[model samples]
Structures are given as C-alpha cells and as structure tokens.
Target: MAWQLEGTYFENCNCNMICPCSTSGLTEPATRDRCNVMLAFHVDRGDVNGVDVSGLNVAVVADTPALMSDGGWRMGLLMDSAASQEQADALGAVFGGKLGGPMEGLGPLVGEMLGMESRAITYANDGREHSVQIDDAINVKVEDFVSPLDATGAGVKVSGVGFPADTLAAGHATASTVNIFGLSWDNTGKNSFSAPFAWSA
Candidate 1:
C-alpha cells in the first residue's frame, strides 16, 4: 500500500532565533549542550495507505545528545486523545521508527523511547500572526516577516537555514526539566520554525 501526508509543522530549537542546523553548521552551546526541540504537525487532509488520518494531531519531542547529524537521539510522542486505538498504533508506528518515513533516518540515533501521551494541539492563525501550544512542552507567538531587519539592535536572528517560511509564524517555548529514556532537556529560551512537509506510509 502507498499513502501520502501533507501538513504544517513548527519546531522550537535550543539554538538562537534562527537555528543554523537547517543550513549552516550544527549548534554547539558553550556547555556542549544538546538540541532540544518539539515538532507539532497539523494534518489538513491525509491518509496512511487505507487508513484515514485526517484531522489527527502528532507531536514529537526529541533530544540530540549533540548535533542532530550525529544522531543518538531520545524522543517522546504525543497524539490527540480523540484518536482510536488503531489510529494511535498507526501514529506510533510512523514515529517510533516502526514505519518508514522522514523519521526513519533518525531511528539508529534513538534511545530510551518514552512511549506516547494523549494531548491536544491548539493553534490560532490570523494573517501573519501565529500562535501554537501543545498541552505544555510548547508555546510560540511571533509576527510575520515582511522583509529583513537591520543591525544587532534588531535582536539576534539566525538565518541561512531551511524550514517552512510561509506559515507566518513565531513563538517562545517552556518545557519541564525532562529526562526520559536517553534524553534530557530544560525549559529556557523561545523557538520559531514553520514549513510544509510531506510523509508517506
């Protein structure tokens, strides 16, 4: 069977405003810290082979011991509570490295999987204004970029990376001091990344 999924997602990284991993070199915090990020996907309309997966929400929390390219990751997953057992299974398979998708490449780097939780995703998209929250691990609010800003006083914004830039999004994040399986994280700083993505099953 063959299936395709198209949706919108946002990621909040521990790096500066514009994470460099998307294009430039990997992130290296002074403490040699890792990158902690949360990705939330909103499926406008999608299907997994014969399974109807429209309107379902998926959230992935990941921690890379070092640069993402180095792999050795730890992850947790959250799904909408409204999904049925089958739906949950499908989502788990897709994200847990059970099914082949964009996530599969990260499988070898994964350790200490924290299983899955039931949660809801909320978003408010009003023109260039965007806000999203995932139960708790994520909270973002940002303004749309009409053009470029000037000088250092413009605040620190990292560019030269690739992500969904059309969602007109932004936000800061706060998470618990999380250490599950092989991952650990702290809730400090904000995050902002949005882009369109596709997946298969």
Candidate 2:
C-alpha cells in the first residue's frame, strides 16, 4: 500500500538519432547542445500513498537549460481526464514532485511547474509503433528500432542510465505534436524511445 508503480513511456526530444542526455546526461553535453523534450506514460499498475492508480496515463512537456544534472527545468503536465478525481489528484502529486518516488530526484531539476490539466489522454501501441494524444494539444508516435544483433527486429536497448526507465528500447519519432508551454515543433525523425519502468518508495 506504500507508493509503488510499474509503467512505460516514450520520449521524443530535439536531438540527433541517439540522445546523449539518456547516456551521458548533462556531464557529456547534450546531443543538440541542449534539451527540450516531451514524454508520455501509461501506468499499468500503480499507487500513490495507498491510492490505486492503475490503467491511467500521464504526459509531460518540458524545457531544460544545459545538463539535467545541473537542474533548471520547467514542466507542464497532463493527466487522463477519464480518471476519477482522486486518481487525477494522485497523479498530479507524483508528476509535480509532491508525492515523490522515482520523481523525487526531479524535484531539484524543476524550476517551475507550468500547470496540470485533466484531459483525454489516448495512449496506444500497435505492435511496433507507439502513439499518444493529449486532448487536441499534443500527439506523437515512435516506432521501435531493429538492433544490429537482434535480426528479429527487436528494439535497441540500453541500461544503467539516470532516466526513469532502467532498460529502454530505442526508436525514432514518427510524429511530434505540441501546443503547450510555448513549446512547438514537429519532432518526426528525431530521437525517441520507450521502456518499462518500476519505482517504489
């Protein structure tokens, strides 16, 4: 009944094929020399301080200065409108760093919480391609990549990084949509990935 979660997310950022932020973080300089990103998550199983939060989705829009290790990120949030008020409130607390857990470390990095909105979040996947929609403001998709060794076309993966996901499957953005926080871009052809994650505290 303590706070715990198991989930997956796909992130798209304005960077080269592979994002350095995921591997080197801020210490090794950004892929494009900075970090601006949007990510969406589907919590298959979760709870916040005993509040059940299964089968819900959340999305975040953010901008960062320099390395993420140095802190100074601004963020906006979107929680699934289909969720009950309690579910939405619990998700807001975690996403906003109020409840803490895997997101606790993010607290120091975030300089501002743009806001949280309850919206219709459509998160889905069709085998290889992943898609997410937040109301009419954001929509994006990423397709898993084929690893060099995995001839079966399994997704490229990496581990031991600072991202919420411990092992993430790599991919590229197929579409990137934005209309929140003055952030705008079509990140298709940019860096992207997804991973199953677990966090407890």
Q: Return the top candidate by lDDT.
A: 2
| Model 1 agreement with the true structure over 1-201: per-residue lDDT tens digits | 766677777666666554555444344431237777766677767776577778777878877764666766667898877778887777777767677776676677776576788766675555444556665555555443443463433333335443333222343444323343355565445455565567775
Checking candidate 2 for backbone clashes, the offending pairs are: none
TM-score to native of every candidate shown: 0.73, 0.92
Output the lDDT of residue 191, model 1: 52
Q: lDDT of model 2 at residue 83?
A: 87
- Best of the candidates, TM-score: 2
Report clash pairs, candidate 1. 72-109, 73-109, 140-171, 141-170, 141-171, 142-170, 164-194, 164-195
Cα lDDT of candidate 2 equals 0.81
Residue-level lDDT for 36 in candidate 1: 79
RMSD (Å) of each candidate, 1 decimal: 4.9, 1.8
